[model samples]
Target: MRLILRNDLRKLMFALLLLAASFGHAGATPPPKEDQIILALIQRVEARTDLVFVRNGSDHNATEAAKHLRSKYKYFKVELIDAEDFIERCGSRSELTRKPYQVRTAGGAVRDAGDFLREELRALRAN
Candidate 1:
């Protein structure tokens, strides 16, 4: 009888530990607002296949642009304060060539990448 009770007590303790762990995970903090905005911007870039991203005098597809932007975001994350900062630092220009990035629409209209992203950001905020 004592052995049976000991085993039951051990099981109860294990159950309690699992419950506590689950509660701890539930209370974990989420990413900052800036990070959320930056991720949204990246997603926007990835979804827009109609626009050509111009970096260093070459054009890239949306997938390539999104990948490049993600790498730049990771590299410059520590220095970034907000979504605008991220656009300016990571999405705006080529770090090596010092040339501003551009976006060409399907109709051959060109605009600065920074301006495009800023407009997207504003649209996101509006919604």
Candidate 2:
């Protein structure tokens, strides 16, 4: 290999820096949520919930996913509200903020999804 002169090395380094900067944000997007085939995903989640026992899903965050599961189970209720809406009502600093569907049920009855479902669904349905 031939030695690069000081000036040549400087230029090469600058060129490399430019190239690196140009590709800096190539993979920076937040990532697309599979909106197109959301229906398919909902169906699959529903099937999974049915095959197994207990509650499975969220409330405000995963409305679409939850609704699909509910439809499949006929007893589960999936209510999706805007994260901002939850924050606005409950306050932004709340841990549940931005979660939208954090899977909250009544009286800590999450383990008992089928039992007291009416009470839990009503609570989850709350804004």
Candidate 3:
């Protein structure tokens, strides 16, 4: 009877180990490379105080632009998988306001948010 009990314990331990191993792979997969690039671009865009973005037919500073994008992202109804989706649905324009956001760079150059982000992504992909 003791030997049988020991055998049952070993089987239980082995089952537990298998269960743990299965759970390890169940966690979310890492975000794609483009997502990382997009996040970095968002951070950089957020940090720049000089850049201006037009939203809702009004001008917003860099911080406000970042905040707006983050808000859009959070309240977004759909699952955002990549930077393209975020840029299209949130960063590029206001769905409610119907205004496309434009970014004014530090050098006094103005660009559409989508174009600017695509440019940034291109540069990053090049490296």
Point to the candidate with the largest lDDT: 1
Give the clash total for candidate 2: 4
Instruction: Return the TM-score for each candidate structure.
Output: 0.75, 0.23, 0.62
Task: Between candidates 2 and 3, name the one with more favorable lDDT.
Answer: 3
What lDDT does model 3 reach?
0.72
Each candidate's number of clashing pairs is: 0, 4, 0
In terms of TM-score, which candidate is stronger, 2 or 3? Answer: 3
Range of the 10 consecutive residues with the lowest summed lDDT in candidate 3: 25-34
> How big is the positional error of residue 65 in model 3, measured in Å on the Cα after superposition?
1.0
Clashing pairs in 2: 59-101, 60-100, 61-100, 61-101
Off by over 4 Å in 3: 1-35, 105-109
Question: Which of the two, 1 or 3, has more lDDT?
Answer: 1
Over 1-127, each residue of candidate 2 has an lDDT whose tens digit, in order, gives 3456877988999999999989753433212332222333343334433232222343433444345343432321122232222222222122233332233334433333222232333344452
By lDDT, is 1 or 2 better?
1
The best candidate in terms of TM-score: 1
**Number of clashing pairs, model 3?**
0
- lDDT for residue 40 in candidate 2, whole number 0-100: 38
Q: What is the C-alpha RMSD of each candidate to the true structure, in Å?
A: 11.5, 13.8, 8.9
Whole-model Cα lDDT of every candidate shown, in order: 0.89, 0.36, 0.72
Per-residue C-alpha lDDT of model 3 across residues 47-98, encoded as one tens digit per residue:
7787788776688887887777767766652456567666777777778776
